[model samples]
Target: MSDKKRRQRLVQWPRVALTTGGVVLAAAATTFVVRTGDAASITADSGATPTRTVVAIPGPRTSTPPPAPVTVTVPGLPVETPVRVTPPGAAAAPLAQVQVNSAEIVYTVAGNQRPDDPVTITYADEAGALRTVENVSLPWRLTVIPTVPVNYVTASSNGSQLNCWITDAHGATVAASTDNTISATCNR
Candidate 1:
């Protein structure tokens, strides 16, 4: 070929590139339009899932108070006169169980040998296991306080069976008088 023909071909190179780019852009735009139109038709047709948006609005915030004693008395009840109903030998019997905090066992000397006197009742943790051990550090004869986490206890040192009254962290009796001696189940 001659130099003049070669130069003419080189000068038209930019035009060729522009034409190719324009065709590609046009094809892309046509494809987008076809897709959009098909979308509308599909929505109008049967068995097409509609555009659904899930809206979640949060619930109202309210401040709740910690659990404490609340005494509620109803109106119009029969007023009764004070009557002594002490049994023949009930008050004379020592306190079988008493509520306490944390995890510890203390005795108030029914005797130095008694496992539980003025029995301390507490749960193992928030997990609801009864404290049942005789934790006397130095054989306490009188007023004894032992700081040990005891499990559920059943029998006394005097070869007699004792009642188990397990209480929760709130000082409320959770389990009173279990049928079994080994385990104590607290109420929910």
Candidate 2:
């Protein structure tokens, strides 16, 4: 290479380095100045107090006297007060008379009774016929009641015959019975 060309390249290297360093220094200084000025403005605005204005003044306070107490007396006959009873219609209705049809029975066997104990059965009287015996000849339905613990699984009806079986805790048959019109009690 020629001597002038080599000298020109060496001179350009220092200029390039100086330009990059200047750009980096300028960016850092600009960021520092912006952050410092923002912090100073925030601190000054937060600590500064508002100017006060003159307002009206009230007169001196005074204390007031307490009121006199009045005593009450009652003519008594007995130490214990007697309660007066009120009729039902004169007041609100009692909560016991309210009827709730929807209810679920939770069965749990404890103590000496086995979990799979046999259930007893009882019968409820069927509804009487509304019409006279000579006017209508309708078949009667029997209602069976199980006294012991049993869960009703399923009931099937075929013609005049109705078969039903109740199960205990161990899935054992507690009672099984079949009846036409007459109610029968079945126990395992």
Candidate 3:
């Protein structure tokens, strides 16, 4: 402890271990730039208390998404085609053949038929598939025909309280929700 004061404490212990390894490598590079740097802003003094980041600068990506005016639900019950779409060298919008036409039903029967009680007319189309009209006579006017727009029209009898109607061909009465009691359901 006397050879020049032990060589001046081994050169001041390597400058205090290289100044504590450069302050711990600058606090591990400021905690790796605050956990994987995007660095909107970061300041440090007393244990680093400077952070205000909200980096989400993304506003430029519409390669083709400004053309949306096509609403065509065709196959059944929805037919309104106006289709519009063009953005990417443009010019391509010509494909429409919406032909869905079929409507006729004058299934009327005005009461009182008891010749052994026989006046049955059960009809259901539009995929449910069932068409029938049996032993029709008296005050009846059957013509329940359709190509796809009539789901039902049933007229049963016990011989009293009978006033069924479903006319369309100027006899107008489009859909009164008669899914019961001398049933009739169209426009679906």
Candidate 4:
């Protein structure tokens, strides 16, 4: 067409392009805003409110009173000296006894052996019977040997007293007759 007509058409093309770009940008912004607002409302509704409910458990409402005490009397006792015996299911047995079989000795040395230096001895009583006796004493012989010997001797008896003697390898008396039922350790 003419020169003025071509110039007007070129100007109109730029305006149309700008209006199309503005409409596309507005549509994208509206979609983003609407989607973000819906997501925020869903999260707030789920988290901000909570439902409440009560649970009940059943049992006895009140406690019961204890049973009354019962009295008991033993025969052969005086009327004034009434013995109070506990009911069958009231209390349990308290005391117990254990029996042992044998005894053991543990010895320790500090330095070189000398006739005057005292020896140390330890005894563990494992005898079951209460009347068993364990004796500890040094030998009478003063002979110098490779190692100084400490003796542990045990005696058995039905009675409480245990009478025994401690002697050296030479048969000489280290300690005279001693009486003890329980286990003991002595150093000379």
Q: Candidate 2 lDDT, tens digit per residue, 6-26?
A: 999999999999999999999
- Which 10-residue span in candidate 1 carries the lowest summed lDDT? 57-66
lDDT of each structure?
Answer: 0.39, 0.35, 0.51, 0.38
Compute the lDDT of residue 91 as modeled in candidate 3.
32
lDDT score, candidate 2, position 20: 99
Instruction: Provide TM-scores for the models.
Output: 0.23, 0.24, 0.19, 0.25
List the candidate 3 regions with Cα displacement exceeding 4 Å. Answer: 1-110, 125-128, 133-148, 151-164, 167-172, 175-188
lDDT of 3 by residue, 55-117 (tens): 221111133334344343322233343434332222345488543224655555455566677
**Predicted structure with the largest lDDT when compared to the true one:** 3
Expressed as tens digits, the lDDT of each residue in 1-188 for candidate 4 is 99999999998999999999999999999999999988867865665433233222211111232243444433323345333443212233557653322222222111123344333323222232122222323322112121224443343333233333333332333433343443223333
Clashes of 2: 1
- Which pairs in model 2 have colliding backbones? 122-145
Task: Report how far off residue 92 is in candidate 4 (Å).
Answer: 58
Q: Pick by TM-score: which candidate is best?
A: 4
Candidate 1 per-residue C-alpha lDDT over 1-188 given as tens digits, one digit per residue, 9 for 90 to 100: 99999999999999999999999999999999999988867765644443333222211111322232233332233333333332111223446765444443322112123344333333343233454545432122111122434323233433222334433333334334434333223322
